[model samples]
Target: MRVSRGVPSVRFVTALATVWGRAWGGSVSFDDEFGLFVCSGMRGGFARGGTTVGGVFLTRRPPTRALLRHESVHADQWARYGIGFAVRYLWEELRNPGSRNRFEIEAGLADGGYRAERGITRPDEP
Candidate 1:
């Protein structure tokens, strides 16, 4: 597990997310191991599995290890790209929705709970 210290601006965004998570009635806690603030039980205001803003992860429930692993990659992306990651991600998502998104591919489709459909053939059909 690589620990990511996002850039200053990204960290500031994370701090804001953390505060929002708490205000949204989520249980916020910093995980030293992952170096992320895990915010669970948010009433609303996230999409899909959850949302990771820099080092803060906001979710509706406790996350599975695979989901956390997927989200950690997003955190790394935020660190690498600073605050611009959000815009880049949106562009990528618009260009390639769902499993086709480059960031999602980089993060591992299976880990992110997306079906892997590249090379498997059904035994009966093929």
Candidate 2:
């Protein structure tokens, strides 16, 4: 699967996220470092950094470099799976929710900033 930005499927997802960001009063900005769309101040809804909708990363607070990196991993998953990413992700969520999911594990709990409260440690970690 070629995950090019020129693809129509990817473009459509980006457009959908743009509309959602606008509706939620979230400001969209492109992060050159991570090469993803960041939508900040997107509060009072299903809060998350995502790629299921598009290459859009939604957050209530300003996104950090690490956060963008975490979301970029999700975007890669979206590109790899295309429309099926959401379905597969949903299935995974049903099986394992939160930091326990394999996807979140691959994304890295610390890098994803979801480890702060959970106090998770990798098998290799001391």
Candidate 3:
């Protein structure tokens, strides 16, 4: 997944994640426990979870099944789009901030633990 000398390099991100994760008291593992790279000790920035530059998932705490599922959706997105994923995501967010963004909507508000702030609801909810 490493692209040599490119705008978006997976290897670059992976390498950075190793150091970054360790700095935050986390580590990177090969197992796709959360369907992608999971960093255990990330803080600030992404309160819930975020896909890093190299498609790594950094969470403030251990992710629950629901949170993992939500982040997995984003992982799939990154996989499908590769480096362009962030651009597309940013574009969508810029066009429509908050839960209204289709990506976030697709990820599920509750699944990503954004139900309250984003005002998201499941189809089953009233």
Candidate 4:
């Protein structure tokens, strides 16, 4: 899975997890720091989970299922790469900026999943 610059959702979450590792468990909650993130990516956000290997931040607001997938993939991303994986993740994305290979890219794809209300894009790519 790769870091997403756009929003995330649940559909993408599942895919990203597949690339990194099987998800043992996951959930959503509110946070003053980033609003939303996977347990693994919670590292260093205003959120309480603290900096994990993934440690991602949504900064603006919480997203929908698409956002969930976006963040969840990050969870698996850390699981696959370790705390230092962020740099590598960036490197990979930079090296290959294509959705065909990246989780976030897949997340935003037409087959990707998204919420109905966000208006960020069409709901449920699949």
Worst 10 residues of 4 by lDDT: 42-51
Candidate order by lDDT, decreasing, is: 1, 2, 3, 4
- TM-scores for every predicted model: 0.87, 0.80, 0.68, 0.40
> Which regions of candidate 2 deviate over 4 angstroms?
1-7, 48-52, 116-126
TM-score of 4: 0.40
Superior candidate under TM-score, 3 versus 4: 3
* lDDT scores of the candidates, listed in order: 0.81, 0.68, 0.63, 0.40
The CA lDDT at 112 in model 4 is 32
Best candidate (score: TM-score): 1
> What TM-score number comes out for model 1?
0.87
lDDT of 2 at 62: 81
Candidate 2 C-alpha error for residue 71, in Å: 0.5
lDDT of 1 by residue, 23-83 (tens): 8889998766566779999998778878998888899999887878778888888999889
* Deviation in Å, model 2, residue 107 alpha carbon: 1.6
* Candidate 2 worst ten-residue window by lDDT: 44-53
lDDT (C-alpha) at residue 69 in model 4: 48
Better lDDT candidate (2, 4):
2
Give one digit per residue, the lDDT tens place, for model 4 in 5-122.
3324433543454333213233333333332443332222333222223433332233445555455555555555554555765687677543433544533543333222333432
Q: After superposition on all CA atoms, what RMSD does each candidate show versus the true structure?
A: 5.3, 3.7, 5.2, 12.3
Superposed by TM-score, candidate 4 places the C-alpha of residue 123 at a distance from the truth, in angstroms, of 22
Q: What pairs collide in candidate 3?
A: none
